[model samples]
Target: MSTLEIRDLHVSVDTETGPKEILRGVDLTVSSGQTHAIMGPNGSGKSTLAYSLAGHPKYTVTSGTVTLDGEDVLAMSVDERARAGLFLAMQYPVEVPGVSVSNFLRTAKTAVDGESPKLRTWVKDVKNSMQSLAIDDAFAERDLNTGFSGGEKKRHEILQLELLKPKFAVLDETDSGLDIDALRVVSDGVNRFTADGDKGVMLITHYTRILRYIKPDHVHVFIAGRVAEEGGPELADKLEEHGYVDYAGASA
Candidate 1:
C-alpha cells in the first residue's frame, strides 16, 4: 500500500559551463507491486532521475519533492534513503578493493536495519541468494567487483536487491554489458525480487529486451529530462519497432 511519489523533480549537475539542469520536471508515482520501466535515448536524464532520487552528491535537486509513504526522501542522507526503503542499482557498480562481497552485503544490511543479522542465518541467506543468481561460492571472499565480468557485476547488483529487499528499487541501465544468456539470468533475479507482490521497481534502460523478461506493469518514455508519455507494456513493443525516433526533437 506504500507509494513512492515524485512531483516535478528538477535536478542539475556541474559542468564547464556551469550548473547544467538534467531532470526538467519529472512527475510519477509508483506503488507496491508495480514495475515501471523508463525507456529513452542515451544522455536523456534517465540516470539523473535515478541518482537524484538516491541522493547522489553529484546531482543536485533544484526543486520538487520525493516521498516514500509520506516520509520526506530528499531530506534524508544517502544512507538514510536506503534505510527509508529506497534502493538504486547503479549502471556501473564500483570496485571496492578490500571489501569482500559477503562483508559488503552484510554491512549494508546491518546499516539499513540498524542491527547485524545472525551470522549463521545470514550465511544461509547469502548462499541461497547467490546460488539463485548463479554466482560462485568463491566470490563470497573476493573483493567487490574487483575483477568480475560485466555480467558478474550486474548479477552482484541484483544479488544485493534480493538480499536487501527494499520497498522500492530504481535500476539504472542494468541491461548494459549483458549478453543474451546473462541478460535472462539478471532478469530472472529482478523477477524474483518483485514476485512478492509488495515491492516496487523502477527499471531504467534503453532496450525492451529486459521488458520481455521482467514485464513492467507500466512503461514510460523519458525525453528532455521529463516523462513524455506513459502507457502499458504495449508501449515497449512500439519502441522496439520504431525506436525512440518518433520521440526525437527533444534534448536531454
Candidate 2:
C-alpha cells in the first residue's frame, strides 16, 4: 500500500530579505483510501505544501523529508514524482494553446503507464469519464484549456485526475472560483477518482463548500505556515462558522 508521509517538512523561497519560510516543520501522514483537507487563510502555505510535494523547484525544501511508500520523494524529479504516483491539480491550471486534449492525454498516459494505451480502449475510457462529468466529447478536440471557461478549466483538471489515477493527489484549492454547478461537477469527479480505495487525497482549500460533496476523513487548520490544529470532518464545519481567527492568533 502506497502512503504519502511528510515528516517535519520545512520549505522556503528565495527573497530579497533572504529565505522566506513557508511550511514550518510540517508533519502529515496520509495512507491510501483517506482524504485529508488542509484549510487556512491566504499565505498559510497550503499551496506551497502542494507544490513542494510535486517537486516544484521554486520552493526549496530546507529540511525534513517527504516519503512515498517509504521512498524519498524529495529526491525525485518533477517528472519522477509524477511517475512515482503523485499528482497535483493546480489552483490556476495552466492553459497550453497548442496541445489538444487528446494529444496531452495520450502523452501523459504513455508516460505514467509506461506504454501507450491501446487507442480504441483509451478513447472509450476517456469518453466514459467525460460523460460521467457531463463534459462534451467535442471539448477534447480543443486545445488544452485554451479559451475554456473557468468551469471548463476545472473540469479539465478533473479529467486529468480521472485518467491519470495517481496514488496520491495534492489538489490545491480546486474549489476556488467555481460556481455552484461547476463545484458540483468538479466535486463529483473528485469523489469518483478517490472512490477506488487505493488512492489518497491531500486537499488544500480555503472554503468548505466542496467538503459537502467529498467529505474529508481528516481536516487540518494551517496557520503561520504550519498545521495548528488537526481534527475530523467536524473541524471543517467549525472553520466554516468561526473562521480561522483563533488559528491565526494561536499560531502567531
Candidate 3:
C-alpha cells in the first residue's frame, strides 16, 4: 500500500504586507484505503496544506517534509507530483478557455502515464466514467469549466479522479455549492474509487453533510494552522451539532 506522510510542515505566502506564515508545523499521515476529513473555520490553513502538497508557487515550504512512498514530494515539480500519484481537486476549478474536456483529460492521462492510452479503450473508459458521473456526452466538447455550473465543475473533478486513479486525492471543498443530488453523485464516485482499497483521500470540507455519504475514517479539527484535535466519525457528529465555535474561539 502507498503512504503519504507530512511532518512539521511550515508554509509561507507572500502578501502585500510581507511573507506570512500560514501552515504552522502541521503533521498528518494518510495510508492507502483510508479517508481523512479536515474541518475548520476559514483561514485555518486547510487549503494551504492541500496546495502545498500539490506544489503551488504561491505557497513556500520554509521547513519540514512531505513524501509519497518515501519519495520527496516537496521537492518534485507540480506536474511531477501528479505523476507521482498526488491529486488536488481545487476549491475553484479554473476555466481553460481553449481546451476541450476530452483533450485535457487525454493530455493529463498521457503526462501521468508517460504515454498515450490507446484511443479505443481510452474513449470507452472516458465514456463510461462520464455516464457514471451523470455527465452528458455533449458536455465533453465544451471548453473546460467555461460555462459549467458549480455542481458541474465539481462533477468534472471527480470524473478526472475516477479516470486518473491517483494514489492520494486531496479534495478541497468539493461539496461546496453542490445540491444534494450532485453531492450524492460525487460521493458515489469517490466511494467507487476507494471501494477496492489501495487509495487515499483527504477531504477538506466545512460541513458534515458530505460525511453522511463519504464516512471518513478519521476526523481532524484544524484550527489556527494546526490539527487541534482528532477522532473518529463521532467528532463530525459533534461538529454538526456544535459547530466550529469552540475551536474557532481558541484559534482566535
Give the least accurate 10-residue stretch of model 2, judged by summed lDDT.
243-252
Error of 3 at 73 (Å): 0.4
Give residue 146's error in model 1 in angstroms. Answer: 0.4
lDDT of each: 0.93, 0.91, 0.95
Prediction 3 global C-alpha lDDT:
0.95
> In model 2, where do residues sit more than 4 Å from their true spots?
none
Q: Tens-digit lDDT track for model 1 on 1-252?
A: 789999999999999999999899999999999999999998789999999989999999999999999999999999999999999999988999999998899999999999999999999999999999888999999998999899999999999999898999999999999999999999999999988899999999999988889999999999989898899999999999999888777653
Better of 1 and 2 by lDDT: 1
Q: Model 1, which residues run further than 4 Å from truth? A: 250-252
Q: What is the lDDT of residue 135 in candidate 3?
A: 95
Q: Give the clash count for each candidate.
A: 0, 0, 0
TM-score-superior candidate, 2 or 3:
3
Please give the distance, in angstroms, between residue 167's alpha carbon in candidate 3 and its true position after superposition.
0.3
True-structure lDDT of candidate 1: 0.93
| TM-score on alpha carbons, each prediction | 0.98, 0.97, 0.98
Best by lDDT: 3
